[model samples]
Target: MVQTVKLMKNRLAMYGLVWVLAMVAMACSSDDGDDNAGSREVKFEVTGNFTGQLNAVLITASGGGTSESINALPWSKTITYESNVPTTQISIAGAGGDPGETITVKVIVGGKEKSSTPGTATNSGTIAVAAPSYAF
Candidate 1:
């Protein structure tokens, strides 16, 4: 009888282990068909009548990366990102331009303008503009 009880206990432990493993596997599995299910088209544009070359021009790209341009007026960038984050930031900065020059930054998502901001160069010829945070 003692041997039978030991065998039963071992079987019960094995069954419990199997159940736990099954639960873990199910928990780890994804119900969504694809990990990159939803994607967004993001575009950043900078336009202005700033005279002279723009220095240190910086623009944000998808995946929180940035790209720089020099003397590139009316610059724009587009990216497609499958992001889980609810919001993304878009901005632009330039220096060494003519004083009192004007600059405008825009953030477009899915071909719709989401945010726009205007900036002017300081007396030292520096300007920075940022669009409102884009919500997906």
Candidate 2:
């Protein structure tokens, strides 16, 4: 009778171990369909008929930081990030160009234009433009 009881206890322990391992395997498995589901492509652009170079250009980068560029005309920057990003911004200030020349700042997301703003150069031959912040 003692031998039979020992065999039953061993079987019970083995069953418990198997159950625990199955639970662990299920917990470690991933059920989500796509790992890149929230990924997005973002682009910032400056364009128009402004003659000279663009200055004081500020753009929001993929890592949620501002980047500056000087003497960049017809400028564009593209980055990829997750959709959880809160906001993105772009701006150009006091660009020296022909008076009355036009300039536009734009934010594009996922191949679509999210925001655009246009400005005209002042008589002093400078233009400043800023696009509205884009929210994911």
Candidate 3:
């Protein structure tokens, strides 16, 4: 199935990103959990700079079911952000099982802002994507 192959590719890309984020989180001693349903609190390797350059990578899930699509999210959509918390959330809008399976939250940043500086990693509510002013 062509669609299946495409889904696999997308999953791989997202996994790679999450792996990088996990390593960074370990270095900072931050919490990680599946915000949608798992309670994961991953530490992001981004320093505190509210210049509006940081963006949250929001991932909504998709699967088979009756009331599919939670949060009224479009089929597999991604949202951009401008400075927010180091953590983002991902999950199927209304799949009724759990949040997005497999490393859901990850960074869309090309590089780590902390790699260049020691004692890096910022903690602010700016990385949140569930705000009213958030872009979908």
Q: How close is every model to the real structure, measured as TM-score?
A: 0.60, 0.60, 0.21
Residue 65, model 2: Cα distance from true site in angstroms: 3.6
The per-prediction tally of clashing pairs is: 0, 0, 20
- Supply the global lDDT for candidate 1: 0.56
- lDDT, candidate 2, 35-126, per-residue tens: 43233666878888887545433323443344354445687888775545444455565534689998887877766666688999899776
Q: Compose the digit string of candidate 3's lDDT tens values, residues 1-136.
A: 6776445445534553454344334433233222332222222222232232222323222211111112221122233322433333332111112222211222322222111221212243112221111111
List candidate 2 stretches off by more than 4 Å: 1-39, 56-64, 70-72, 82-84
Error of 2 at 4 (Å): 97
TM-score of 2: 0.60
Candidate 1: the clashing residue pairs are: none
| CA lDDT scores, all candidates in order | 0.56, 0.57, 0.27
> Candidate 1 lDDT, tens digit per residue, 1-136?
6776445444533443444333333343221333333436767788888764443222223333333443566878776655653445544555456789998888676666666889998897767665555544
Candidate with more favorable, higher TM-score: 2 or 3: 2
lDDT of 1 at 74: 89
Q: Total backbone clashes of model 3?
A: 20
Worst 10 residues of 3 by lDDT: 127-136
Which residue pairs in candidate 2 have backbone atoms (N, alpha carbon, C) closer than 3 angstroms, thus clashing?
none
**C-alpha root-mean-square deviation, each candidate:** 23.8, 26.7, 16.8
Best model per TM-score: 1
